[model samples]
Target: MRTDSEIKSDILEELAWQPNVDETEIGVVVEDGTVMLTGVLDDYRKKVAAEDAVKNVRGVKALVGDIQVKYGANYQKTDLEISKAIVKAFEWNTAVPEDEISVEVRDGWVNLSGEVDWAYQKDAAKRVAENIIGVKWINNAITIKQSIQPADVKEQINKAFLRSADIEANAITVEATEGLVKLFGTVHSIAEKKAAEDAAYLSPGVHIVINELEVID
Candidate 1:
């Protein structure tokens, strides 16, 4: 446990160490482990960097950043650039389903909605949206679809299993039904078990992976 003063000091130290931030330019207020940052930054990236610096601190309960940026006046143009940046980021990412996801911008706020096959894709979508300039906030309304075909699912699971060196292909039992893959087998360690599951997840049509594989001690 850390005292409020200790947490405040830690927050300030972290912010000072961040790239392009001057310690003298930043002011911090602490009340019961919640930090409020007040300062002026040269650009939007520094504004974001300042907030992120405090966010990753170990004892930080919450962050309220009131940092003003010189670029705030050009927010409308910034918003358009941010929207374009987010679109380009997703278009090149293989894990993201760009066709299923739609990015809408309103007053520098981004709203993302659509269906994706995995939880990782949902997280990735949010990250891309946040990196865009002029983005005051993001609304993530992505849904996950767990329905897929059995034969296609099975083939994908088999390919994933065979890709691993530790998985004894002959002993592995994989069954896919309605986009859900159920694995029943023995693996040497927990790492192998996780790898096997991840491999199945990367398959194009897989919606859910259920690992029933036993780990040997």
Candidate 2:
């Protein structure tokens, strides 16, 4: 067992090893084994890595990441460029509905506000914003709407199979809404299950593909 201050110091020291993030930029507070991380990271990956590092540490009961991402002023990007990236994020990501989402950038911070049908889409939108060169932090204020029925989920799964080459479209069952495609039924192997998921991810409006297909022994 360690004191809160001791644990916080240890967490700060651990974050120093992460690339693209300086310890000076990181602030840690440990309250009864719950670690709260605060600081601005240059990229979202570094932020994620920082959180993961804290989780892997011994005696961490839970973690709260409040890492702020701030893009370098050295990187120059126009408002149009930021806007375009926001739109492209929606177009390329099947999970996010472009019509429902909105993006705004100010002094390197990206703010996203929208209503998505699932939690994953909100996550995806934030991820897209975090990937941009000048995005320092993302303020995601998106809401999750109602989900579709199980039958609708099956339809999405079938559509995913139909889009694939190897999988038998007729044999697979799908349940979908808000970009999460759940596949039910037997497949040849784990590889087939993965293949089905990959296909569904590439589908026009898919955010996540749940590979629920069981392996038949």
Candidate 3:
């Protein structure tokens, strides 16, 4: 196992490598493979980028992000303006169902709520909100509609894992209870672990994915 200091060093390097993240503004603390990030950023995207970078590090078992997004005076906008922008963004994005989702902005934080047919649509709505300027953070409460029974959810996810070269389908076991899916097994890296969870979310009726896959790197 890598030491905490080593994990911190890799996280710092990863943050520096990401174009959207400012390494100097972020402070990284690592203990027992868990990382806590603290900083203030001008854009919410940078904060998200920082978290993603940290997660990509090999030794990171968990992450706690406390980054604050504070816009400059010139970049500040009223809540109404932010909401309008998000709505417009959703409308323009083909993947997001603009009519089905509701947007509420408070002090630059956006709260999205509604139901969509697919997990991809729900994710697309959040992605649209993230790109809008002055969006400090996003609470994606959008849910996926159960268009079909989840009786075959586990089978479908297992097939998806088999189709992907990144995943070791035989090594991972999938469990489904209604719309909730759980993954248990071992993966070679953090990226593979994430891939398994993403595959689980793509199943027709899956609403939640509990990724308990251990990284054995």
Candidate 4:
């Protein structure tokens, strides 16, 4: 097992490798593979980039983001403007149902709440929120409501995990209730755990995937 100091050094190196993030402004501290990010960034996108960069590090178990979004003078937007921008942006996306999603902005943080039939649609809405320039943060509260028989959901997800090249099928377990699926097991990496969850979401009638897959690497 790698020491916390080794993990911290790797996270810093990962941060430096990310082109979008200003590594000098960020601080990282690790304890038993848990990483805490501090300091400030110019945009919400960069903050996200920093987190994404760190997650790819081998020893990182979990992340706590304490990084602040320090909006530059040119990037500031009123709540109404932010709401309007996000709404307009979503309108242009083919995968996202513009009318089905509602945008609420308070203090430059965007809140997206709506219902969509597919998990991908909910994810599309969140991507739109994340790319907007003035967005300090995003709360993707979009819910999925699909018409699928609950019994078939588990079988379908199990088959998918078996098919996926990245995931170890036997190590993971799946449970389904209505449209919600709960995953429990251990995986080799964060990427594999995400792949298992993606497989669960691909199964029809799945609205929420409660991923309890632990990364054992």
Candidate 5:
């Protein structure tokens, strides 16, 4: 375990290392391993980078990014304009299916709701929304449409884990029902745990993945 002061110093250094983020504008507070970040960022992407940088530091528990996104004068857009632009962008994006998603904008925050056949489509919708000017934040409420049978879902997940040289396949367990997959067991780190969860999601017909994999350093 690391002292609170040590953890704070490491987080500050990490934030400074991120070229996209302005560390001076961000404030860090630590108490009992929980980190709370309060500040203002020029871009939403920079806000996300700060969170990721904090997560990369060990001995950090929960993270709360209460940072605000400060929009410039040139980036201002009306709610109606944002709505129309997002809808048009979705139509132009090949990865996202047309008319499969609905866009709602309020106070510069974009709310996306709809169903898509693949995870990539859901991700694509958010990606396009994030790059748009004047978008303060985004709420991706997209769902996946899966029609794959539950049979062999477990075996396929196991096989994927086995195929990956970085994963310990035997240490993980898979359970599937209809369109949902549940993962149980332990992983060496957060990266390995995410890898296992990604494998579960990659399996066809897995609309929901319940990851109960514990991280053991």
Candidate 6:
């Protein structure tokens, strides 16, 4: 097991290496295996980048990001302007169903609520919103339209794991109840853990994925 200090050092180094994040503006605290980040950045994307950097570090069990996004005067936008921008962004993205999603902005935070046929579409909406300037944060409440529960949902996900190069199918177990899927196992890295969760989400009728996979590396 890696010590907290060792984990902290690696997190700092990872943050510095990420081009989108300014490492000096952030504070890192590690206790046990959880890391807490506190800082302020000019863009919401930077905050996300910082969080991703920490998660990629080995030995990090969890993260608490208290990073604040305070846009400068030049980057500030009215709620109406933000709303318009989000609408335009959704239209440009082919993956998102523009008409099916609703957008509301308040104090630079975008709230997305609607229904989509696929998890990727819901994720696409949030991804588009995250890149828009002046967006402080996003609440992706867009839900996947549930269909008939597949009797072999768990088996289908297991097959997907076998086909994917990023996942080790043997190390993971899949459980499905109704439309919810639970993953329990061990992965060699954080990336692999995420891959396992994403594969589960891709399975039809999987409304929620509970990833309890431990990163063993």
| Backbone N/Cα/C clashes per model | 0, 11, 0, 0, 0, 0
Candidates 1 and 6 compared: the better one by lDDT is 6
Highest-TM-score candidate: 3
Write down the TM-score for model 5.
0.83
**What lDDT score is found at residue 26 in candidate 5?**
96
Q: Residue-wise lDDT of candidate 2 within 18-48, one digit each (tens)? A: 7666778778888886788887766666886
How well is each residue in 1-217 modelled by candidate 1, as lDDT tens digits? Answer: 5677887787778877987777678898887657788887655567767777775665655568787754456544555677788889999888778888988887666899998877568767887766666766678887667655778778867876777785666567898776667888876544466667767776655666788876543
Error of 2 at 124 (Å): 1.3
Ten residues in a row with the worst lDDT in model 6? Answer: 143-152
Query: Which ranges in model 4 have alpha carbons more than 4 Å from their true place?
Result: none
- Between candidates 1 and 4, the one scoring higher on TM-score is 4
Off by over 4 Å in 5: 2-4, 163-170, 188-192
Ranking of models by lDDT: 6, 3, 4, 5, 1, 2
- What TM-score would candidate 6 get against the native? 0.93
Whole-model lDDT values for every prediction: 0.72, 0.69, 0.87, 0.86, 0.82, 0.88
lDDT of 5 by residue, 77-123 (tens): 89998888888888899998858899989998889998888766787
Q: What is the TM-score of each candidate against the true structure?
A: 0.56, 0.53, 0.94, 0.93, 0.83, 0.93
Better of 3 and 5 by lDDT: 3
RMSD per prediction, one decimal?
9.6, 9.8, 1.4, 1.5, 2.7, 1.5
lDDT of 5: 0.82
- lDDT score, residue 110, model 1? 80
> Which candidate achieves the best lDDT against the true structure?
6
